[model samples]
Target: MEVAGPSFLLLILLLLAPLSVHSTPPPYLSPAIFAADYDDMLESFRIFVYGARRTFKFKSEAESLFLASLLGSPFVTENPSEAHLFFVPFDGDLSERSVARVVRDIRADLPYWNRTLGADHFYASCDGIGFGSDRNLLELKKNSVQLSCFPGSGGRFVPHKDVALLPAGVAPAGEGEPRGLSSNETIEHLAYARLGAIKDPGLVHRLGGDPGLLIESEPSDRETFERRLAMSEFCLFDYGGDVSWIGDAMRFGCVPVVITDRPIQDLPLIDVLRWQEMAVFVGSGGGAEGVKRALRGMARERVERMRGSCVAASRHFAWNRPPQPLDAFHMVVYQLWLRRHTIRYARRDWS
Candidate 1:
């Protein structure tokens, strides 16, 4: 009788409990810059420019423009003491000494670096030409968010911590411009080889003589390239130095057929963008057969759906002058925002 009574009571208690769970609020991020003192609205957002001149001019113009765009955004804060994140705007050649000098100076001048061991700090670089060789830079890269054009796996690119920036050429289509979805091109496949040769011999051989595929040894000039891209239904992308052409393909309403053995680290807005919905990924082992299989598997309706998604996702990869919402610049910031959500910084006395 006692056991029966206890079981009855437990059943009643379980029945009365609420089933739904409430979601938590997003974390707040107030990013602060550790740059030189300047009077040009350094305290305000969207107008304040990071007061560092182009020291290492590798892709100086692109670097300069990106820095200006980020610094001019509302995410920046004047007071380091009240900030939740830190940014070190350093541009030039990716020299360990130059980066080290900036890091050392900032760490000495501010307590933020010591607070999180530079975990919350970030540096932006468009040039991936020379930063890989230095051991110190590699270690530094491990600790901070590295925004660059070459955000690949292995080496210093930690996907959760670093950002892969979209190249400058992938700008949004202007008004009256022909979006790629409506193209009437007869070609089914388009491949441009800027690197002279394909890494996979099997893929090279398979696509080399295919009548339906257009394999160009050299890229056409801008106008011709866009025209060819606009005409095709599927554009081929491999593990090249940069995957920026994916953006171009999407802009032209072509579904990208990514053939890579390694992970694609430089995909723009990956945390937010559902890449599988817009592009096709063929593994290295699959070779040309895999690519053809993927294309064959995609029914006309599914291909149309993917093309629609690609058209929708194109704007996220586009760069605007003032940085409109969801554009490339904002997308980078949004990536940083998402990164901020992953981290929980310990409260420290900035006073």
Candidate 2:
């Protein structure tokens, strides 16, 4: 009458696995609720992220990890039948089991998915992570990724492994921008500055050509982008959402002047750079125009050094060096092709 059996345990594991899988999406990604074509593919990607996260109300740490994972996911899916370039988010309650299961699903799907999506179509933007100075990534022999995005991150905390250094002469040998000015350059009509609010209008009035060229009226534009990189020896980006723009300046080779009020006391990614070594910083108490005067007053050699440092600084961090927008698309699309053409064609696993 005493019984010993493994079948029941196996049944339970099988049932639980699929149920957990079923719990993850539609609601999490909420694609059905997506309202617009989002103008561009990038916009579509953003809207998808926005709408999906909107459904959750969680603590900041959860939000950060979620974002990192979301960006890190290797399974790239765009609706196959429609021209839709975005996929719905994985809708699920944020339990440990749920998260773990989803990660499993992604790992399983990626290689097969790549085979399905045309090799040229898209690729996962998932860059593997690594430790501070460890070759953890290299040990795995993961492919090297290109840092294709913007300001190139003006912040100081990027990890050492992530930084890419420019050789000498391409960037000056030290602590500010290099020695000579590109005399052929002319400060143009759009030359301008960016900051949250300018307490002192002195530099703003001086370098900022028209009263109309206000941060509020125009916000930051391509013109502001051109101006900051072109006219000044360097640029300063701090405060909310400055990460994106700071990245842009780095991509353009302009030195970044940075200071932050945010209590990001632990972002090792921003800590790798020597802040005062190449770029300038106005403490949190210092406002916009004041920071501007600091940049404007620096000597040409200092600017060149700063520029070199900016380039040197850019070598680190996934954010400072974003992959090309096209690369993600290529990853996603290629996976889809391989899945359709090879795996499904042979494995007959799923239609």
- Give the winner by TM-score: 1
lDDT of 2 by residue, 1-351 (tens): 121222444423432232110121111112221111111222222111213334543332222333344444432233333222223233333443443344345335543323333211221111212222323222211222212112223342223212121111111112132122255765332223464323344534543554423243243566554444545445544533334344345434455555554443322122223455544556655554555556557786555555554443342222211232212222222222222221223334433
Candidate 1, residues 1-351, lDDT tens digits: the string is: 011112333433332332111111111121111011111122222211224444434353345556767666665556554444566776555466777777777767766676666777777766432354454454457777777764354554566777887666575557224264333345445444333335655577787666667777566477877766766778776765445566776776677777777777666666666677778877878767677777777787767666656665676676778776546776676566555523544555442
CA lDDT scores, all candidates in order: 0.58, 0.34
- Candidate number with greatest lDDT: 1
lDDT of the structure predicted as candidate 1? 0.58
Quickly count the clashes in candidate 1: 5
How do all models score by TM-score?
Answer: 0.72, 0.35
